[model samples]
Each structure stands twice: as structure tokens, then as C-alpha cells.
Target: MIDLTSIYHRAADNYCYLFDEETLHIRIRTKRDNVLEIVLLYGDQYEIVDHQWITSLQPLEKIGSDSLFDYWQVAIKAEHKRIRYGFILKNTEQEMTLTEKGFFSFIPEDSGFFFCFPYMHKSDVFSSPDWVQQTIWYQIFPERFRNGDPLLNPAHTVEWGQEEPSLTNFFGGDFQGIIDSLDYLQDLGINGIYLTPIFLANSNHKYDTIDYFTIDPQFGNINLLKKLVEECHNRGIRVMLDAVFNHCSVEFLPFQDVLDKGEKSLYKDWFHIHKFPLKDGDTINYETFGFYEYMPKLNTANEEVKQYLLKAAAYWIAECQIDGWRLDVANEIDHQFWRDFRTTVKAIKPDLFILGEVWHDSVSWLRGDQFDSVMNYPFLHKSLQFFSYDIISAHQFTEDLTTILHSYSDNINQVLFNILGSHDTPRVLNECRFRKERVRLLFTFLFTFPGTPCIYYGDEIGLDGGNDPGCRKCMPWQEEQQDLELKDYIKTLISIRKETSLLTSKGTLYFLPAVNNCLAYYKQKDNQVVFVLINNSDTEIDYVLPFSLSGKKINLLLTQQEYAAESDELSVTLAPYESNILSFYI
Candidate 1:
């Protein structure tokens, strides 16, 4: 047997957590080459008599393996809110028991051999808003959504859809415009709206914040915002506003004071000024977000700055009753600030959703102390690489996705904000090179995947753009200018997601093995199973179902095709660039 002294740990990730007072998630890790399987021997900590402990042996699934170790996981309920657990490791030829003390040939009678979870408390449980699981979010770039009140349009504002978007351009989109298009969003089946920075800022994008307390004049006044929030809530839609606390626009009053009175400014500590005198040009002495001169990084470490930003976050929820805050540049800020931010926000509104804009692995921020969820950019990248770019084969795609699912706890993965295209990336249709079939397959995977899927504004109607400025095109109100077919397809996908409980956020995902360029997976919840198949290759292929479907009724969700399994094996032919979602009721 492999050496048991190579490593030792209880649970490295946030895998050990109390979902509630009784349910506990526990996980352990061992050397990748050491153990073939592990069995968790656990029971109530006090269930012992006459030098023997009563315990239950439960097998641990090998969730994932990295270069050094293999991660095994399990979730159990401690009826008494206390647990004593130990691990039994096995190889092909040998078996050994592992405990808090060390490895042994047999289970030890002493209680010290087991690791103890004294008690599971309700207060320590990590949870997000209940409404998040059923939500289908629609992200709106406010300036590009609509133009309801042209009177409030900026002096330099151009015609709504006539002008191409530039770095600095406005089309007079406002809250009233959003209010006017409530029916459109509601009919499209969106239950949540994530609006990018609507606070007062000089730029049309509004990330460069000039004021946080007041709404942008171009967007509307506080009354208009209240009305917007009320309308959205009335329609059962939750509104999440963007919070850019990492930095502020150079035009901000505090930054202006620092620029005018270099050393004498009382607000000098508010920002990170490298030198006494601040000069402009290519050379930047102080820290900024990606070296941009106009957007100076805020000194979030300071207590004063923390209080100021916390107040701004509290102001929106307390005054307008906004549902949540989507933090901008969330990773650059300190963790303590976010922990405090969560405390401040959750105290006022307990169920408020907090989403962080993190592009990479965000396990650190999602430990239940900081943000509720983060933007799933890793999923998007891997998806595009497999479906749109065809850089990876079907097997590699599944392997990469499995690694992602195993990286986080089950609870964190359920509420993850999954996105295909956003304000930051190229439009999904553009990424697919305007192929409608590829777009369909992409959305099919997105809606069926286990998370809350987000739709960027105008993507439903076949809006195509390269990147940032190009992706921020004005919403087309006219029926002739829109792709009605694609819009209807997306509407149907949302309807399926809402109507089907298993497809929404909680479903067991299984990646079926495929031989060629075709990909398939099964999403099973209870007795219902949804089998999704996508043909990425150019040639038609006859694919066989991976599992036995004998005596079960099969109905394809998208095409409405029906079939009966005569034998244990069932085969179907998939056209090039085609997709199918088969539902089997057993």
C-alpha cells in the first residue's frame, strides 16, 4: 500500500459546513496515487458503550483529483447536531483506518481516534437568498437598453440605434425606458434584473462613479429609481444594482481635493497617492484599476473609506429596497472589507443577494462570509472553447467541467451566476460566428446546467458584436430590426427552465461518455431524467444512448420527437450542428 504519512487533513475547502442545524457537509483528501477508495465511519459523538463506539460506514465518492491529491466528499445529517468521524482507506491489496491520531490496521476503541464536530449551529450555516434558485437573470447596460424620455438625454447623445458605440457615447437610455419595457422582460420570463452601475458618473458606462448616493441624471432621479424598483418588484422581478467601490472617477470630490491640494488635502488618505504632487500623463505613480488614469483606485483598507462605501451600499437597499449588489472589481479589494460588507448589508436585508464580479476561481470569496455568488466566467470560457471554437474534444470538455463542479461545495455551485455573454465579453452570437445552431446548443447547455443562467441585454434577439464597445449596442425596439425566431427560441428555453423543477438549479449532472465530436449528459432528479446530446462535428453521426431506457417513454424537449426503447440500447442519428434534449419518465 502507498504511504499513509504523505498527507493528513480533515477538510481543506469549505466542504465542512452546516447547511442547517442538522445537515453537515464533510470531505477529506488523500494522495492521488495512494488510495483507490475511502469509507467514512461516522456516528453521533456520544454513541459509545463498553469501550466500543457504534458507527455507520458510508462510502465516499471520488469527486476530483489534482496533481497531488484525490478529493473525496460526502454529505450527512447528524440527528443530534454532533458527529464523530474517521476514514478507512483501501488499495487493491491492503486496507487501513485513518483517524485523528494516525493510521491503523483496525478501528480504535478510544474516542480520540475520531475527529469530532462538537455541534452544528444554525447561526454558522451558509445560505443565500431562497429566491435566487428560481431566478433567470437579465443583465441590462442601462445606457444601451432603451430611450423612453429623450428630454433627459445628454447634450452629446446621438440617435438611439443609428450610431455605433464608442468608448464615450450615450443614447439616452434611462429608468423610464426600463419601466416602459417591463412587459418585454416579463414576457421573456426574466425574474431578476442585474443593471450595470446606474449611479451618477461622467461616462456612459457609469463604472467611473462621480456620486454613489444619487442616481445618474442620465438614468433618472431617486423618485424614478424608486418607481423602477417598485415596478420590477410588482412584476416579481428582483433588481440588483452594480456597486463600484474598488475605485472612483477622477471627477469625484475627494479625488479632486487630493489633486488640488496635494499635501494639504484632508482626504489624502482616502486615495493611494504615491507622491506629494499628482501629475497626469502616461506615467502613473499611484495604483489604478488596470492603469486607467481617469479611474483612481480607492483606499478600501481605510476605516473611513469602508464606512463611506458601506453607507452607500446600505442607502440603496434601505431607501429604494433594491434586491442586491453586484460588486465591481471584487477580487482586488480585501476580504475583511467584504466580510464587513456582508454584515452591513445582511443586517438590513437578510435575503439580499450579493454577487461578485470575479473572472477566475472564486472559492475564497464564496466561503459564506463574503459574496453569495460570483460571475462564472470559467464555465463560459470552457463552453465557448468546446462548442464555438472547437478547440477541445467532447471528452476534454466534460473532464474540465467535472473539475469545476468538484472545486466548490454543492451549495455554492447551485447559486453560481452562470453567463454566456456579458458587458465585458464578445456577444454570444458573435462568438458563434452568427450560426444560429451553435447559439441554440450553447443556450441549451446553459439553461440545463445547474445554476442561475444570465442573459445579456439584446442577446435574445440575435444582437452580434465583437467586444466591449461593440457589444454595448442599443436595444432594437422595432420588430423588423429584431431576430424574432431567435428571441422566441430563448423565450421557450426560459419557459422550459421555469416549468421544469429538475432543470432549474438543483439537479444531479452526469457526463455520458462519447466516442466522437458529439457530447451528451444526463440531468437526473428523482425518477425523471433529461438526456442532452450535442453534435459539434460537421458530419451526421449515429449516436447510441449510454444508459438503458427499456420500457420508458422518451420525448425530445426541443424537437418534440417521441420514441420507445425496445431494448437496453437505443440509437439515434444527429444532424450536423444539431442538439437534442430527451426526457425519460421511468
Candidate 2:
């Protein structure tokens, strides 16, 4: 058997409370070279008898592996919220039982030998807002969305949709524009709007924040924001504003003070400065987000900075009654500040959502104390690889998705900010090489899959662009320029999503086997099931439903067609780039 002496630690990230007070999530790590399967034996601590242990066995899944170790995980629901658990690990050579005491050849007779979770408290459970599951989010890059109030427009603003966007250009999209578009958004059936940074900043994107307390004049003031929030709430839409706390613009007051006063500045500790004289040359004297010298990284570890940002967070929620915050470059900041931020914001509004922008695995910030969820960039990457690039097969896509699903607990997976396109990336339509049919298939998969789905602005109407300045195009207001069919299709999908509970975050997802280049999955919640099928290839294919689904009445949600399965293997033909969302009673 492999040596188990080096493995240890059952702390926060390794073991966590998931879903509710009764559920516990645990992870174990072993040397990377070992090929071992682990089974957990767990039961109530009080259930042990004399020299006999009454326990249940659960096999752990190997969720992830890196260069140094393999990580195994499992989630167990203890009825009493107290658990005594031990691992039974086996390799090709021998098997051993591991507990708090040590590894042994047989199970320990005493309950004290097992590892114990004292109690899973309700307050410690990781949960997002209840309203999140029901939300279909729309991401808006304000500078390009619309120019409702031209008086608030920037001096050099160009004609809407006439000129291509540049790094310095602004098209005058503001809060009033969003207020004016509330009817359009309501008609589109989305209940959540995620607006990129609206705080005072130097650039058009507002990512390099100048002042957190004030809204940019180009985007309107606090009054406009309040009115926009009220209007959105009136239309049954929740608003989430972007928080750019990781860095600040060079022109920011504090940063300007630091530049003027150097080491003598009282605000010197707010930023990370490397030298006595702050220089603006290509070789940066201070630490920055990237190579850009203007966007200096904030010292989130500083106590004063922490309180300042936390207060700003509390101000937005308490004053405007916003529903959530989408943290920008969240991974670079220290986790402690985020914990404080969460406490500060949730104290004002307990259910306010906190979403972090993390591109990779965010297990560290996703505990009960910090962020509620993170941007699902991995989902976008895998989906694009399969649908846009056509590099990976359907089976590989399913396997990749399964790995992502297993990486986090079901609770975190449910509220993940799943997005196909955003301001930073190329438009989804452009990624698909302008293939409307491919875009339709991707949309079908996005809506039917588990998690809260988000659409970037202008995506529903088939806006096409490349990266950065290209993706940030002016939203076309003219109906003749819009793809009404695509918009209507997206609206239909949203309507179906809102009406179907199984398509929401509460549903349990399962991947069904299908032919090459064809992907299929089923989501089930209680008695209702939603089966989704997508054909990514250029040729037609026949898909056979599992034997368990035979003799059931299936209702196609989009086409409004009904069919009755006749045999154990129900066959359906899908043309190239065609997709389907079928609902049935089980």
C-alpha cells in the first residue's frame, strides 16, 4: 500500500459545510504517484456501540489532480448535523483504514478513533441569495448600451453605431439609458442586469476607478443611479453594479497625493509604491495590475484601505438598494478584505449577492464568509472550444463540464455566473464565425444547463465584434439593423426558463451518452425533467433516449410539439446545428 503518513489537514478549503446545516463536504489528498481509491465510512457520533461501529460507506470521487497530489472529495448529509467519519483506502497491493488516530488494518472499535465534525451550524453554510436561482442576467457595458440623455454625453462622443469603438472613445451610454430600456429588458424576460463599473473613472470602461463614492459624470450621478434602481425594481429586475477595488486610476485623489508627496504622503500606504520618487516611465516604480503604469494595484491588506472599500460597498446597498456586486479582478486582492466586505455588505442586506471575477478555480474565496459565486470562465472556454473552434468532441466537452461540476459543491455550482460572452472577450456570434445556427445551439445549451445564465448586451439581437474595443460596440437602436428572429428566440428561451423550475439552479444535471459530435443532457427536479440535445457536427444524426425514458410523453418547449415514446429506445433525428429542449413527467 502507498504511504499515507504525509497526508493531513481537514481545514476550510479542504473540508467545508455545503448546501445546508446537515450537509458536509470533505476532501482528501494523496501523493500524485499513488493509484488509490478511497471510501468514506461515516455515521452519527452517538450511534456507536460496544466494539461495533454502525456506519455507512460512500465512495469518494477523484475530482482533481495536479503535479504534486490527487484530490478526492465527497459530500454527505448527516441527519443530526454531527458526523464521525473515517476513510478506507485501497490500492492494488493492500487496503487500510485511516482515522484521526492513524492508519490500521481493521476498523477501530471506539468512536474516538474517527475524525469528527463537531457540528454543521446553519450560519456557516455557504448559500447565495434565494432570488439568484430565478434570475436570468443581462450584462451591460454602459458606454455602448445607449445614449438616452444626450446632455450627459461626453464632449467627444461620436454618432451611435457609426464609428468603431476605440480605447479613448465614448458613446454616452448612461443610467438614464438603462432606465429608458427597462421596458425592452422586461419584454426580453431577463430579471437581472449586471452593469459594468459605473463609478467615477478616467477611461471609458471605468475599470481604473478614480473615486468609489461618486458615479462618473459621463454615466450620470447618484440620483440617476437611484432612479435607475427604482425603475428596475419596478419592472421586477434586480441590479448588480461592478466594483473595481483591485486597482485605481493614476488620477485618483489618493494616488495623486502619493505622487505629489511621495513617502511623506499620509495616503502612501494605500498603494504599493516601490521607490521614493514615483515615476511614470515604462519601467514602473510601483506595483500595478499589469504592465500599465496608470492602474496601480491597491494595498488591500492595509486596514484603512479595507475599511474604505468596505464602507463604499455598504453605501451602495444601504443607499441605492442594489441587489449585488460583481467584483473586478477579484482574485488579485487579499481574501481577508473580501471577508470583511461580505460582513459589511450582508449586515446591511443579508441576501445581497457578491460575485467575484475569477477565471480559474476559486475554491479559496467561495467559502461561507467571502463571495457567493464567481464568473464561470471555464464554462465559456469549454463551450467555445466545442462549439466555436470545433476542436473537442461532444464526449470531451461533457467530460470537461463534468470535471468543472465536481470541482465545487452543488450549492456553489447552482449560482455560478455562467456567461458566454462579456466585455473582455469577443462576441459569441463572432466566436461562432457569424453562424446563426451555431449561436442558436450554444444558446440552447446555455439556457438548459444548470446555473444562472447571463447574456452580454446586444447578444440577443446578434451583435458581432472581436476583442476589447471591437466587442464594446454601440448598441443599435434601429429595429431594421437588429436580428429580430434571434432576439425573439432568446426571449422565448428566457420565458421557458422562467416558467420551468427544472431549468433553474435547483435542478440536478446529468450527462447522457450520445453519438460523436452530438451532446445530450437531462436536468431533473422532483417529477419534472428537461432533456437538452445539441448536434455540433455538419451532418445529421439520430439520438436514442435511454430506456428509462420510454413510453413517456415529451413536450418540446421551443417548437411546441408533443410526442409519445413508443419503444425502450426512443429515436429522434436532429439536423446539423439543430438543438432541442424537451420536458416530460417522470
The TM-scores, one per candidate, come to 0.93, 0.91
Candidate 2, clashing residue pairs? none
User: Could you tell me which 10 consecutive residues in candidate 1 have the lowest summed lDDT?
Assistant: 6-15
Error of 2 at 164 (Å): 0.5
In model 1, the runs with Cα more than 4 Å from the true position are: 1-9, 12-14, 28-36, 62-71, 100-109, 280-282, 505-507, 562-564
Question: For all candidates, what are the clash counts?
Answer: 0, 0
Highest TM-score against the true fold, candidate = 1
Residue 10 local lDDT, model 2 = 66
lDDT of 2 by residue, 1-586 (tens): 5777655436355354455666678777777657478899898878757757679999987765444566677879888888888888888987888888888999887878888888888887878999998899999999899898999888888878779999998889988888888989999998999999999887999999888999999989988899999999988999999999999999989899988888889999998888878885656788898878889999999999998898899899988999999999999999888988988898999989999999999988987889999999999999999999989888778778876875677778888999999999999999999999989888988888778999999999999899998999999988998999999989889988988877775534787765868998887667777888899988998998774667789888888799887766777788998887888877
Q: What's the C-alpha lDDT at position 442 in model 2?
A: 83
Q: Estimate every model's Cα lDDT from 0 to 1.
A: 0.86, 0.86
Q: State how far residue 58 of model 2 sits from its true place (Å).
A: 6.0
lDDT of 1 by residue, 445-524 (tens): 88888889999999999888888899999999999989998898888889878877777655347777765788888777
